[model samples]
Every structure is written in structure tokens, then in C-alpha cells.
Target: MNHDRSHALFTRASELLPGGVNSPVRAFKSVGGEPFFAQRAQGPYLFDVDGNRYIDYVGSWGPMIAGHAHPQVLDAVARTMRDGLSFGVPNPLEVTMAEAITSIVPSCEMVRMVNSGTEATLSAIRVARGATGRSRIVKFEGCYHGHGDSFLVKAGSGALTFGLPNSPGVPKALADLTLTLPYNDFEAATALFDEVGIDIAGLIIEPIVGNANCILPREGYLQHLRELCTRHGALLIFDEVMTGFRVALGGAQQRYGIAPDLSTFGKIIGGGMPVGAFGGRRDLMRQVAPSGPIYQAGTLSGNPVAMAAGLATLELIQAQGFHDALEASTHALCGGLEAAAREAGVAFHTTRAPGMFGLYFREGPVESFADALGSDAAKFGRFFHAMLERGVYLAPSAFEAGFMSSAHSEADIAATVDAARAAFAVVAAA
Candidate 1:
């Protein structure tokens, strides 16, 4: 592929933006390549600055469930744009969006809108502290709930990609408020609660764990955590930013049959636009500013364009058989890839949960971040470039999950498996 345009663009971006990209992951630092600046995306395909087309599996990191530039969502945004964009004040769209969120996500009886996932997680943590009158919170090591100071103590995603799972700018005092433990470790979670359960304001986690490559909760783990949180009187906060509408319409709460006190949402809801939200029990949500003592504000909190896009996106996903079809496609891709890897003499273990999946170059199950790390990164990186050369796109890092959108059909899955088969051959031969 001709990367002349992408290479030049990266150089220009580095001179202007931090790390040559708006987001760290988009830099392609882990894969050692010039980031391909996207020209446009439609129907699960990304066209790059060089005009190379790729079958996109990242799906803008778990949004675009219905596909990029989906007509319904785009039309909503276009229609709303005619009304002007921001109004540093309330709008009917905001109210309607909140209602849509609450209707679909049962845990969110009341929710507050924010501009990004970071703000949503930060606000949720503050609300927890204010409502419980406590100072500390508990989060899993591999769970990425955006880049809030509390969430960054040992976040996944960008932090993991940079090899700095624990960032430096976060003060030790503030970091002290967050207790990070290995994900999917029930004993450790229980042990922490036993030692400092009384001091924990709340517990936050990505119930399906997309950040560490879709590591799922071990047998009844979520249910146990919910019960423990209740016993200790700490609120359970589910950071469903990646899984909200993609994993299931109601998210991990619906999939695992667990209800959290507070939940954060992003991605699919925005329909490829920028938006984030946090909501849960009506009483707890009432604690946020204008409702109670906790203070949180955003100038662009409920931008009409984003609201219209999100509402339209949510409505599309809520349509009949949306998730069922998405899930079936995801299973075909993940399952076929696993078989292909095995046939190619690759020591690979794969796992899937609804619309999300993890592909590990290992022999056994990946239950935690440490387990995920045991895989061969050098080989996986090689395989990534090989696949990219074949016009198939994956997440930049091995530690991130791959998303499947409703736009991905059986033909897309079949073509992806063919690409994976060829890529695996290259790595296995090397």
C-alpha cells in the first residue's frame, strides 16, 4: 500500500498535535507504523488518506455498531444541525436522549450527559464519593474507564499501549483513593473489600472488560461482586463505555443479570458522534449538581448534533434482531479465525462475548491482564501488519478487543477469515 499521504500527514500531525494524533492509540506506536488518517468510513470499511480501503473491525473503538455514516444517524445529525449546534443551556433533545438511555438501560433511571467518557467516569466517581461520604474507590487493573485521574491509576487502553499502566502525573494522594486489583480475580476483589470495604465509596469495572481484550467475568463473578458491593454498602459502578449498546441493548447488566448503582456509557450511543453519560439509581443520580450536592458541569454536555446522532443510533440498535445478527456475525469471524490459527500451527486461544472478541496468541485461556501478557506480542505485531497489508484492519494493540458492527455481513466474515489465514501463515512461517 502507498503510504505517502499517511506518512506526510503523520509528520504534520506530530508538529501540531500531541504524539501526532488526537488519541494515543491512533498513533500506531505499538504497531510501529505511520497512522493512516481516515478519509471516510461506510459499511464497516475505512478509506485512508492514501485511498486504501480496509475492512474495519475496530469500529471506531466500539461505536458505529450500525456502520459508519449510517443514513439514519447521519440524517438525524444533519436535521439537528439545521437548528444550530450548542446552546450552553438545556434543550429538548437532551431530555429526549436521557429518556432514551433510561428506557433502554434499566439501571439508568436518571443519567447526566458529558462530552466524553473521561468526564462521565470522573463525574460518576465524584457522585459515588459524595453519596457515600467516602474518599476511596476500587477499580480493576485492566479495566479502562477513560483517563480520569482516579481511573488512570492503573488504566488499560492508552495506558497499556504505552507500557505505562500507571501514569506519572497522577499524584500519589489521589491515586491512593483508587485501589487497583487484577481483573477477573474474585479472591483478590473479595480480599480487598474485606480489608477496606468500609472506606470504599464505590467500585467501578467494565463488566465485560473490553479494554483488556474482552476478558469476561469468570463463573458468576459479576453476581458475586454485586452481592459483595451490596453487603459492604459500596455502590457498584459499571463502566459500559465500550459495551453499552454493542454487547447487548441493556449492556453487561442485561447480559450478566446484574444491576449497578451507577453506569457510564459511551460509543454506540453516540452513533459515531462524541458523547458520554453516567446514570443509575434515581436517588444516586439526584446527587449530581442541580439535583443534589455533587457538582459536575459541561459547556457542551448536550450538544444537539451529538444528541440527535445518539438517539438515532440507539433507536437503530433497539430495532428487531439488531444484536442477534451482530452476535452471529461476530461469532463467525472469531470462531473462524480461531480455527484458522490452529490449522496454521499457531498457539492461539480466542474468546468472544456477544459483539466483542479477543484473539490471543497463547495456548490457554486469558483470564487477566497478566494472562493476556503471556501471549507473543512480537508475533502478534507481525501478524497485524500482514493482515493490514491484506486490507483488513484490527486494533493497533494485542491487548485491545475487536468490535463487530451490524454492517459486517457473512461475506465480510468470510473475507476476513481468508485474510487472517494468510496473515497467520506469514507469522507461523517467520
Candidate 2:
């Protein structure tokens, strides 16, 4: 496929934007190529500037559950835009959004909106510290909670894609306070909490580790964390930015039957718009600014446009069988791809949770960050390019998870599996 226009755009962008892209993974650095610029997206496909069409599996990094350019979401945003854009003041839609979220996720008695996942997570951490009067926070390795300063330690997503889990600018003092632990390891977490349980303010986790390629928690793992936090006087904060509505209507918490003390949401909550939120028990959320002592404010927190889009998206996902269909489609796609890899004699494996899934160029189950890294990166890069050439666009980096949309049809899955069959052959030869 000719990417002449995309190449020219990247050339200009490189001189203007760092790495010629707003996001690091979009640069395709880990996959050994320049990125393709998206001209437009509709349903389950992306049309690039070069006129190449691809069946999209990234789903705009897990927010397009209802799929791109859904008429309902677009109509809602358009209608809201006719009134005004940013009010910088309270709006009814904001209240509706808060109500909708709280109604869906019982753990969130109240919520505060922000512009991005990073803000939601950072603010959540602040609230935890303020409410508990503690200085230390715990996060898991390969579980990304956005790029907040405290979270950059052993973070996943773009940080892991570029081989820099610990960024340079974070101060040692701040980094020292952010404790890192392994996911799915109960003994280590138990031991750590026993040692410094008092100093730790909260434990933040992805619940389902999408950033490290969709690693699910082991049986009873989340319950263990909940128990430990309760015993340690630490808040359990679930970062559901990627999994919120995509995984299930109520998210991983509902699926696992565990309720956290606090939760952060983004991605699907915005319906492809820029939005984020942090919320929890009424008593804990009451501590946030204007309500109590803890301070957290945003100039455009409840922007009308974002709220409209989010509300519409949430409404659509709530329809009966929405999540069930999405989960089945994802399972079908992953299963087909695994069969293709087997036929091609490629050492490959995959994992899935509802609408989210992961592909690895390794054998057997990938349970942790170390296991994910053990997959052959070189093989993944080859397969990524091979699939891209065949009109199937997977996530640009191997470390990232792939998402499915309700808009994806069985025909799309069949076409994708056919492409994967050819791609796996190329990867096996490589």
C-alpha cells in the first residue's frame, strides 16, 4: 500500500510534534515503521490517508465499544454543541453523567470529571492520600494507570513499548513513595502490606491488566487485594479507564464480584471524546473540593459536549445483550487467529476478557508482566506488519491489548482470520 501522503505528513510532523505523533505508540516505534495517518474511521474499519482500508481491532485504544461515528453519539455531541462547548460551570448533563455512572457501577456513589485518564488517576491518588493521611501508594508492575508522576514507575502501555518504564523527569523522592508489586502474586502483596500497611494510603490496579496485553487476575486475587486493603486501612482504587464499559456494563469489578473503595474511568466513558472521572463511596468522595477538605478541580471538568457524548454512549451499551455479543465476537476472532497460528506452526498464544484481547508470539498462558515480555517481540513485529499489509490493523505495539466493537460483524472477523493465516505463515518463516 502506498503511504506517500502519510509519509509526507509524518515528515512535516516530525519537525513539529515529537516523534511525528501525539502519542508514542502511534509512531509505530516498536513495530519498526512510520505510522499510517487515519483519514477517517467508520464502524470497524479505518481508511488511511494512503487509501488503504483496514479492519480495525484497536478500537481507538478501547473506547469505541459502540464503534466509530455512531449516529447516536454524534447526534448527542452535535445537539450539545449547538448550545455551547465549554461552560466551565456546572451543567445538567454533568449531573446526568454522574447519575448514569453511579447507577451502573454501584461502587461509585459520587464522581468528579476530568479531561484525561492521567488526571483521573492522579487525582484519585491525591484523594486517597488526603483521606487516609498516608504518604505511600502501591501499584502493580505492567499495569498502567496513565502517565501520572507516581504511576510512571514500572508503568506499561507506551512506557513499556519504548523500553522506559521509569521516565527521567520523575524525582527520586516522589518515585520512592510509589511502591511497585507483581500482579497475581498474593504472597508478595500480603507480605508488603504486613510490613508497611500503615504508611500505604491506597493500592491502584487495572483489575484486568489491559496495558500488559490483557492479563486477567488469578482466581480470588482481587478478593485478596480487597481484604488486604481493608485490613491495612488503605483504599482499593480500581483504574477502569480501559475496561469500564467495554469489559462489561459494570466493568471488571462487577464481573469479579468485588467492590473497590474508589474507581477511575475514562475511554468508553467519553465515547471517543476527551473525558475522565474518579469516584467512590459517598463519604470518601465528599472529601473532594467544595464538598470537604480535599481539593480537586477542573476548569472543563463537565464540558457539555463530552457529557452528551458519554451519556449517549452509555445508553447504547446498556441495551440488552450488548456486552454478550461483543464478548462472543472477540472470542471468535481470537480463537480463529489461534487456529491460524497453529496451522502455520507458529508458537503463539492469546488471552481475552470480554471485548478486550491479546496476542503473543509465545507458547502457553501469559499470566504476568515477565510472561508477557517473554513473548518474541521480533516475531510480533513481523506479524504486525504482515497483517497490516493484508488490510488488518492490530495495535501498533505488542505490549498493547486489542479491542473489539459491537460494530464488528462476523464477516470482519472471518476476513481478519484469513489475513492472520497468511500473516502467521510469514511470521513462522521469519
Candidate 3:
């Protein structure tokens, strides 16, 4: 309940670090409060420096799927680090990770590891351009594929929360090369592809728009994109940095039964470490770096510690009924939140996938970026602080999706719902 220590830390940090945080959302700019600095996390709870414990739904922006500081993951990291930290040459863990990925997601025949989702996405687009020899890239309006220069145009997440969809300093020429389309719109996609499909190198999407608060693709929408890309000779890249391994075992592509030409991944694969990857059809991935002419390399591409943690996580998720339990938990959490809102006489809705969800201070059917923007963000901000005060940590911004983990027990979910009941009342009163 006390953020005094966090506040003191922020005072010192702000003097040296921009906004007193390494990441923008952590500043709580959208929620109108100073962020709490976490001391440690375990299971589904985060303990702040002030000794306050909160049930965590952000899951470190979607990597702690098995929960925070799982013994298995920690053990793997500890054991791997004992041998060495980084090796310039290829390590066996990297091969095992690649095997795990390719086997789980059949679409990724060959994968290249990177340090972050941003790097993976940047590398993917380059492969798209090099292979196709085209300059234009198409992305959806509310999909946040990291802060790559081209992706910042009409992006989501922190950019949307701050009202800077088109960030400054991106070259006008480069911005022009990146085209934007509304998600879940059939006609807009058709029209755009018809207009400049020839010039387009790739069309990348989030599969599930996690940044704009977890909007799902409409029926057959992904298939339509696949058809368009195939017909137009443009690569289809699924930016599954958020949805990968969270929505389903093989990500949204498998959940929706659509296959993409290239896919970029992060989050769960790292198991709370900093890692990312991009892979897809062999021909397309083969064009990246040493294999072909397109140059992309990372000094720590296959960090053994990260690989060990990720491999442990992958093993855990692959256990029987892991995804089924995850889906049930998501539904239970969303259903309870909706009921709590109803009891409080407040207008609220939630959109959910297997292990991720979005809360809106509005009615149902948040299918597009415009619908997401239509939510009462100011009211949501009030509710956010109220919930945080009650020991439930949702994502800092209404624009970001809240994650669920296999670590969250029914007791945790019930506690979260109870917290929401009181928090919703506060919102209603305000």
C-alpha cells in the first residue's frame, strides 16, 4: 500500500534515466501514477520494493507464461550460466531450441534467433524485401511489432497510449514505404492489395491485435490475408511477439488455421529472459545472412542461459492439458470481471484469447482499432489505479493486453475478481 520506497527510487532514477523508467509504459503515464518498482516475483504475484504484493496479470509483458521465477526455469538458467555466459560459436542449446520451435510451429522450418522482438521483426522485413526485391511493407493499424522505424507509423502500445501513432524522426520516405490497414476489415485489405500489391514486399500483422487490447481476427480473415499475399507474390509475416505460444501451442496461425510465409516471435520463448526469433518457410528464412545474401547477425543470438530457460518453459507448456487449462483460466477471469462490472452497474467488456485478455470501459465487440479507441480511456485509468490499490496489477495502459499464466490458481483468479468487484464500484462512484 506504500510506494514510498518506489517513489524514492524513482526520484533518483528520474535524475539519470528518462521518465525514471527504462520502458515508457512502466512510467504509468497513461494511468496517472508513479510506477512501483518490483523487488521480486513468484507464481502469479509481484512484490514491490515497498513490500506490497499484487496478483500480476501483465506477466512481464507476456513472457512469464509458466509464472515468474519457476524453479525449472531458474534451475535451467543457473545450470547453463555455470558453464559459461556467451560463446561466439554455435551451442547445442541453440540447436535444441530451433528444433523445439520448428517442431511445435510447423511453419517455421528454419529460424534465426535475435535479442528482442524488435530485432526479429526488423530482420524479417529485410528478408521479405531481399527475397522479393520489393520496397513497400504493409502493417495493420493497431498492431505493435516493436518500435522498428517502419512499424511506428500508426502503431499501438506506448505510441497509442501517448497519442503519437506516427513518431517523429522517421524519414518521410521510409514512412511512405510503410502502408497501414485497419485490422479485421475485409474490403480495406482487398482494396489496398489491389492498388499496390506489386510494390509490397511483405504484409505483417499481430494475428491477434494484442497492442490495441487483444482484438481477435474475424472469421476467415487470416485466410484472406494469406490468399492475397500468395496471389500478389508478397510475403505474409505474422508478428507473434505477443500471441506466440500464448494464444495456442503453435500461436495464432495454428489456432486460426492459417499459415504465413514468415513469422517473428518473442515473449514466452524467452521464459522471462531477453530473446526473440524469426522463422518461416525454408526458402524465405534461407535468404537471411550466412545462408544467403541478406546479412543479419547477432553476437549473442544463441545465448545458452536464455536457451535453457526457454527450453524448460517449452517443455512445461508441452505437457498434457497445459493449453486447455490456460484457456479455461482466461475464460474464467474474463467472465468474473464481466460479472463484477455488471454488479457494479458499470459498462465494461473483456476480449480474450487462450491466455491473454483486454478490458474495456465500454460495451462488447472490440473488433477493430477504432472500436478499441472508442473505450473510455480516462475512466479506465481511474479503474486501473483503483485495482492497483486493491492489489491487482493490470497492464499500465488500457491499450496493452493483460496476460494470464499457468501459474495463476483459482484462488488467485477469485481474489482478482473480488478486487475487481470493489474496483468497479470505485469506478462507478467516480
lDDT by residue for model 2 over 300-319, one digit each (tens)?
99889998999999999999
TM-score, candidate 1, is 0.96
Q: For residues 1-430, what per-residue lDDT tens digits would candidate 3 score against the true structure?
A: 8899999999999999999989899999998989999999999999999999999999999999999999999999999999999988999999999999999999999999999999999999999999999998888878888888888875433211212337878776688788888888898888888888998999999999999888999999999999999999999999999989888999998999988999999988899989999999998887777879999999999899899999999999998899999999999999999999999999999999999999999998899999999999988999999999999999999899999999999999999999999899999998
Note the Cα lDDT for every prediction shown: 0.86, 0.91, 0.91
- Candidate 2: list runs displaced more than 4 Å: 155-165
| Tens-digit lDDT track of model 1 for 205-237 | 998878777798898899988988999999999
Give the candidate order by descending lDDT.
3, 2, 1
Instruction: Show model 3 residue runs off by greater than 4 Å.
Output: 155-165
Candidates in order, TM-scores: namely 0.96, 0.97, 0.97
- The Cα error of candidate 3 at residue 32, in Å, is 0.6
C-alpha RMSD between model 2 and the true structure: 2.9
Clashes of 3: 0
Clashing pairs in 1: none
Where is model 1 poorest over a 10-residue stretch in terms of lDDT?
156-165
Model 3 residue 381 lDDT? 96
What's every prediction's RMSD, in angstroms? Answer: 3.0, 2.9, 2.8
